[model samples]
Target: MSKKLLATGLAVLTLGSAPMALSHLVKDEAMQSYRQSYFTLIAMNFGPMTAMVKGDMPWDDAKMLALAEDFAAVASVDVARAFGPGSDKGTTRAKPEIWENTEDFLEKYAALQTASKGLLAAAQSGDRAAIGGAIKETGGACKACHDEYKAKDYLY
Candidate 1:
């Protein structure tokens, strides 16, 4: 092919692919932000419960119930949606293994959702021991995912 023809073809190829690449970049950024916000919300609610259960904070049944409800509501969101392809590359601590081992990652996510429900039920029961056990179970569920799929460090 002529030099001019080669240049034209290269330009066309770049133009055609640029939009798709940009689209994925934008999507990945949004998903990363969404997942991070979800975890932040969960921590805000879960932290107090853990503190109360551990005696780090004074135990209040009403506050426990409220926090558990918020935790469950936040956990109910489909976190798998934020783990879509390309999201593993952005400003996120989500490990690339989440994409490689999708089934396992989702199972862990589901476990968290189930544990959150258990927590809320325990809170409603107004039994301190039950609430403590539920909080432990919920933390275990969170640890299962973090152990496998969450990275300790993120790339800037």
Candidate 2:
């Protein structure tokens, strides 16, 4: 089946199987707020790494590893729980299609998680070349998701 179809199927199965639990599920606003805070952390940590890699800032091994760890922690969050119903309609750049195309978003998130781990490992290895490659791949993963599921401007 197509990704969209698969995503739809999964959504149906999940909701269909958990009616009682979902009845009291967290509010969309809470999810949106948490997701926004998570992304803010991502930006805070990722910006310095990118700047260092791009030569806009001086590099430091200890700092790179610390930032990478912070990024990895954020990447570990289960985004499937964050983009639930109505989250797209608030103070976010998240596109509504993220909820509709859940499988695609999840796959993109998995890529980001992998890239984050690679960056952490690279930072620990203290090899500049490896760290550069890891940073590039991490950036690509982020851009891939943003291109598909994030708006360039505010929805509100």
Candidate 3:
């Protein structure tokens, strides 16, 4: 091949790959932010539910159901992409084990989603006891993953 042709090919290849590489990097950063925001949203909904369940706050069925719905919405998100490769870098507390043992991590994530659904169902029943039980189970599911996957210093 002529030197000119080879140089042109190389330039095209490098330029073409640059966007893909940059897109992947952007996606990784976005995923990290998204993961953090998602957990924050979960906490925002869960904290109040927990207080109500613990009797620290008065029970309000309407409010509980709304909160449960919010939690379920966040929990039901497609988390598979949120933990994408390289997301463990930056200000994230996700243990490296999450990427290494992705199957187990995904299973735990699914468990939390299931628990969130259970909580939603329980909330729909308008039974404080049932809702409380569901909340406990949901919290347990969250703790299970946090215990195994999150960095120790990050735990609350």
Candidate 4:
């Protein structure tokens, strides 16, 4: 090949490889953040759910409802703040595909947030039917995200 042709080929190869390399590095950080966010949000949300279920909170149904709402509000904040377009080596429990397919990840998160809000609304109404529906929706959202984004080892 002519020197010019070789140069052009090399340039093309570099351009293609660069993005892959960058994405690989980013995928690690993204995975790490996913694991951290998962653990954090679960800790925050389950506290109130358990409290309300056990009647441990010194609050009325209305107060429990408020706490549920508070929990949902923090859900989105935690994911948004913790995850990014990159992955980290430290995140073994998280899958790198989340950052790789960010749109889907964000969509799943939005669904979870919406369902969590529904749960809070139902808790506020003190209606058993509504609460059941909302809880199911929230569980669906959690399962959907976990099935797609989380590692199985973390689950078991």
Number of the top-ranking candidate, with lDDT as the measure: 1
Clashes of 1: 0
Give the local distance difference test score of model 4: 0.68
Candidate of highest TM-score: 1
**Candidate 4: worst 10 consecutive residues by lDDT?**
84-93
**Comparing 2 and 4 on lDDT, the stronger one:** 2
Clashes of each: 0, 0, 0, 10
Clashing pairs in 4: 26-86, 26-87, 27-87, 28-87, 28-88, 29-86, 29-87, 29-88, 30-86, 30-87
Q: Rank the candidates by TM-score, best first.
A: 1, 2, 3, 4
- CA lDDT, every model vs. true structure: 0.90, 0.86, 0.87, 0.68
* Regions of candidate 3 where Cα sits further than 4 Å from its true position: 1-28, 154-156
lDDT of 2 by residue, 11-112 (tens): 998888897644433465677667777788889999999999999999988999899999998888876687777677767788888988988999998999
Question: Model 3 lDDT vs. the true structure?
Answer: 0.87
lDDT of 3 by residue, 1-156 (tens): 999999999999999899765553345368776777788889999999999989999989899999999999999898778888777787678888898999999999999999999999999999888998999999999999999898865422
TM-score, every prediction: 0.81, 0.79, 0.78, 0.61
Candidate 2 regions exceeding 4 Å error are 1-28
Q: Write the per-residue lDDT of candidate 4 for residues 11-84, one digit (tens) a residue.
A: 99999899765553445366454556555666576566655554566536666676677767776564655665
Candidate 1: give the clashing pairs: none
Q: What's the lDDT for residue 98 in model 4?
A: 75
